[model samples]
Target: MASFTTPDGVTLAYDDIAPAGEAERTVLLLHGFASNRSEGWRRTGWYGAFERRRMRVIGLDQRGHGESAKLYDPADYTREKLAGDALALMDHLGVRRCDLFGYSMGTRTALQAAILAPDRFSNLILGGVGGRLLEPSTDRGSIMADAMLAEDPATITHPFLRSFRQFADEQGEDRRALAAFVQAQNPPLDEAAMAALPMPVLVVAGQRDEGAGDPEDLARVFPLGKGVSLPGCDHFSAIPHGLTKATVFDFLDGLLDDPFEGRF
Candidate 1:
């Protein structure tokens, strides 16, 4: 575990998982909304995969979440600020370029970072990147209602939610704070804005993604982009599936060469 200070003076936390030798390249893993670095990748077994593959892993706890500062400024949670934290993490580590993998809310941050820095990332692998955040669709909340209602809402939302709630219960990070963060948050970009990103991109979606349009809508936008579906899975379950795992690894493997040069 390592801690770095952002330009904003927030002491952000990151977990560095690497093999003994020099790192081939770093993959920045960003977690979803209300999730922290450890819960993001550590719990998912993805971090273990990266460690076995000999790749350096930089897992971040986004502002206002996890062990990082929990500011309620709302501005603190914007895509711009989230992406900035990524770059700041890299800068602090002295890494010139690396790949990025963001899931759910983390995916939006990945896209935003690639657009803003353009050159800072070699390739982008976006899992559960549904589409533009600004586009309104009723699908997201409705699909999960049945499942959420059936199960304890927090546990179904994420495995660590129960533990997090317990931590927040003792530490005083209220459920209202989490709810307010979600309500105040909106997708930061539209399709046109996303299309302008020049980096090689991969958009993965769940077959039953309720919040965004179907995978076809997301795939149609980026002809150069590869789209794959996780059969029988929704937004949260998609990434851990066999199909998504194969697709993501294959895509990242292909981008390991010079195309990763700081082009955008």
Candidate 2:
């Protein structure tokens, strides 16, 4: 239940888990939208897996989610601001460098953080995201916001929106705050920024996820990146899938063995 105040004065909640043995490395876990650290990482068995690898894990509840300070204004949840919160947490913990494993919405934050401070990360594992990283797409924020505001989930017409509302309700999340968060849309990271990344990266997505786009195509954009597609999984289902974990662990293990194994 530890917490830190961002420069913007938002109090973000986080959990710091020590490695099972002498710490070999540190990993920062970023959860997706409308999801917290516990549900996204801890309950998904991510914390234990990392612990088994002797990696210290730091999972944070992004602003307006989980036990952190919730703001009603959409302007407060920008990508830069969210990224800053993560970097600030690292500084607060005195961790000079670490690896980043971000899923879905969290992937955007991690990418922005890496762009903001490339030297701060050794490797990056981007999961549940793909081709959307390259091109600008329709903003679904309003739809999601509308879904959150809906009085009855059954009344929501759009299947995507309705599903999100149902998940939020099931999780008992703060709908108003999440609605505001949706309003605070993240700016596109663009290909130029990703292509220039110097650290090793792995792009992962479910083969059947429409939102994920083409992971192989997305990976090609990064100078030092590779892609892995999990079979029979969608964006939501991919997060907790065994294949996703295996791919990430394999990529991370490779990094541990030789940080520049595949680099020219």
Candidate 3:
């Protein structure tokens, strides 16, 4: 376990998992909203898998989540700021470049990081997200904020909102702080930004994930992107699903062999 202070002075917690032998590559894993690195990667068996493949793993607890400093101000959770924290973590460890993996809300941060520092990342693996990244949609953030702020989860009629509230309660998250974080979410990345990504990209999502929109559609926007589906899985279930791991690893293996090969 280690910690680093962001430029804004918030201390973020992270874990660096080394390979058993010499490392072939490095990967940075980012978790979703109200989730930490442990539950996101370590608990899902990602750390072990990466280590087995001789890949160094770096996982971080984004601000207001896990062991990181929690702030109630919405201003503290901007997309750019969150992305900056990831880059800062890399700089702290003297990592020049790495493969980036992000899920759900973390995917937005990953995309922003790639956009801001295009040369710092070699490949991008985005899970639990899809075409929603290309256009604006309903304010799910506000709905989630309201859900987290609700006095009673059962009182929230919206099914998704209720589910999020229950999940947050289970995680023992600071509801107020998470609410602020949700409210601070920036707008989705535009078409131009998505098209500008020059590195090989993989977009994966559950077959039944309505929240993710359409993975295939999202992949088409990227010049060097491909989409994979996790059969018989939903948004939450897809994260730890075996199919997700297989698809991601296969995509990563292809990148390792030939980074320029765009087709999967």
Candidate 4:
């Protein structure tokens, strides 16, 4: 468990895993809402894949989740602040640049970071993101936002009851803690902010994402970016595997040569 104090003086946590042989590239993995580093991409063998590619992987836990500093204030969970935390960690670790892989909320933060500091990253892999998340404000969004702030574990867990119970039993994540964490961390980004990001972005999303941001909508955001729709995958199932992993690696390979190229 390593830690860094952000510019805001909040402590952030991260796990650094180095490959056995010579390192090729470094990858920073960011997890989604209500989840930590180990629970999201790390469990999917992404760290191992990076190891196979001789890449050093950094898995970070966002504030208020995992072992990071828990600030219960909702205002502290804004997108700008979240992105700043990543940069602050990078500064602490002496990393000039690195590739980023962010899933769901993590991806949103990654987008903001790339926009806020365009030169901080070599490339980006955004999973489960396609467009502005705060748009089309619905009654459902308000309800979920309130339920999240209220810290109602039952209502939060009802959708993933079986999975949540199994995860708690297996991984020791307190459902109530996660529920409260998720409920309080609802930050929305406006369209202008979303469109300002500059990078060669790769957007990957599940074909069936339960009425979330449409894949096509996300793909259209960056004129030079490419979007890929994962077949036979729901949100969780779209994780890079087999051919999918190869696809991402190929994209990363190209980007490593020319990180600023907007074309996929």
Candidate 5:
């Protein structure tokens, strides 16, 4: 449990879990929307997995979530700002390079981070998001923002978006801050932009994940990318699955004979 105040006065929270000796490999974890570092990774079994593997873990609570400062203004949640926080945290911790892992909203931020600081990441593992990253940004952010700001959750008409409100409630997160994060516009990027990333990327999503599109489509864009699907899982359920762990570890360990093949 540690904290750092951003240049803008936003206090972000984070935890650096590492081996007793100096760390050889580091993984920076970015959680999905409405999820804090602990719930997204530690309690979800990632911390233990990394511990056993002897990899250092840097888990950050991005602005508007967890113990971090909550700002109500949408202007404060730009993609660059979100990505900057990740970079800034790394700078704060004196981490030169790491394997980056992000989920859902965190994946969007990860893309921004990779684009901005292409050399800081050695490998990227994006979960809970897929081909949807290539799609144009639409009004869904506004709709989701409205859902988070809704006085009554029942009024949110979109079924899937409504579930976000419910999940936020369960997590006891700040709806106003989350609404701002949802409303913040992402940078203009497409498949060509994704194609430009040079690091090894693994895009993993649940087979039944309707929230994200085809993971294979997303993976094929990168020169060194691969995609894998966790059978019979959805966006949230895939997080703690054994298959998810295997796919990620195998990729990180370079154990797969054909790295380009999109499955285990």
Candidate 6:
């Protein structure tokens, strides 16, 4: 793993694995909220799958997560700030363009990045995201933030919200940093801007993932978008599932057969 200081002075940790091929295809990975690059992508079979495909893979541990610098200020985690860091990493690595993959919180960052600079991206893959991206995220952030900072995990009665606290505890994440991030205010998603993007996008979600809503709805918003649903999976299970990896691989290889291909 290597570290670089962003223009804003936050240090981020990342891994760059290059494939032994002429094409030198590149893909950038952004992990979910409480996850690091190793746990979110490497241990989840993503690294091996991309290696087998001979694609150059770059994964970043976003600010306040993994080995990256932790900041207790909510303002430090705004959508624009996270997006700036992502773009900065690309520039720091001298990567003009690459395929991008992100999940959950990562999805939000990826979306803002693509919107900010569509020309620097080829294909955009959003996992564990759906129509919820179109809604206001302020409430969601506050709810998760409260759950993360709760004095006792047992007090978080909502099963879905409680899961985050439990996962953070299990991962030994910095609760104060995670709490600030979970409650950070990100600019509401701009669907109009998203629809104008020229790159082909794949929105993938689990069939049982209620938090994501319908991937097809989000997919339709993009001019060149497609949605795929993985059976027998939920939000967390969707990311590391074999089916999820296969679907992502198929889409990346241009072998995907979307269920709602032309409807969009």
TM-score of each: 0.77, 0.93, 0.94, 0.80, 0.94, 0.95
| Candidate 1 structure quality by residue, lDDT tens digits, 99-212 | 898888788788788878878887787777554444664544333323323335555555434443454444444344354344445553667766766667777777776654
Model 3 off-target regions past 4 Å? 255-264
What's the TM for model 6?
0.95
lDDT per residue for candidate 4 within 78-177, as digits (tens), equals: 7788889888888878888999888886887888888788788888788876654546544543344444444444555446343444444455554444
Cα lDDT, all candidates: 0.68, 0.87, 0.87, 0.69, 0.88, 0.89
Native-to-model Cα distance after best TM-score fit, residue 77 in candidate 5, in Å:
0.7
Runs of candidate 1 with Cα error greater than 4 angstroms are 131-134, 137-176, 183-190, 255-264
Weakest ten-residue segment in model 3 by summed lDDT: 255-264
* Tens-digit lDDT string for candidate 5 (38-139): 899998999999988889999999999998899988889998899899999999999989999999989988988998898999999999877887888789
- Candidate 5: regions farther than 4 A off: 257-264
Residue 150 lDDT in candidate 6: 93
What's the true lDDT of residue 202 in model 5? 94
**TM-score, candidate number 2:** 0.93
Task: Return whichever of 1 and 6 wins on lDDT.
Answer: 6
Q: Which 10-residue window in model 4 sums to the lowest lDDT?
A: 255-264
Name the better of 3 and 6 by lDDT: 6
Comparing candidate 4 with candidate 6, which one achieves the higher TM-score? 6
Q: Candidate 4 or 6, higher lDDT? A: 6
Q: What lDDT score is found at residue 81 in candidate 6?
A: 90
TM-score of 5: 0.94
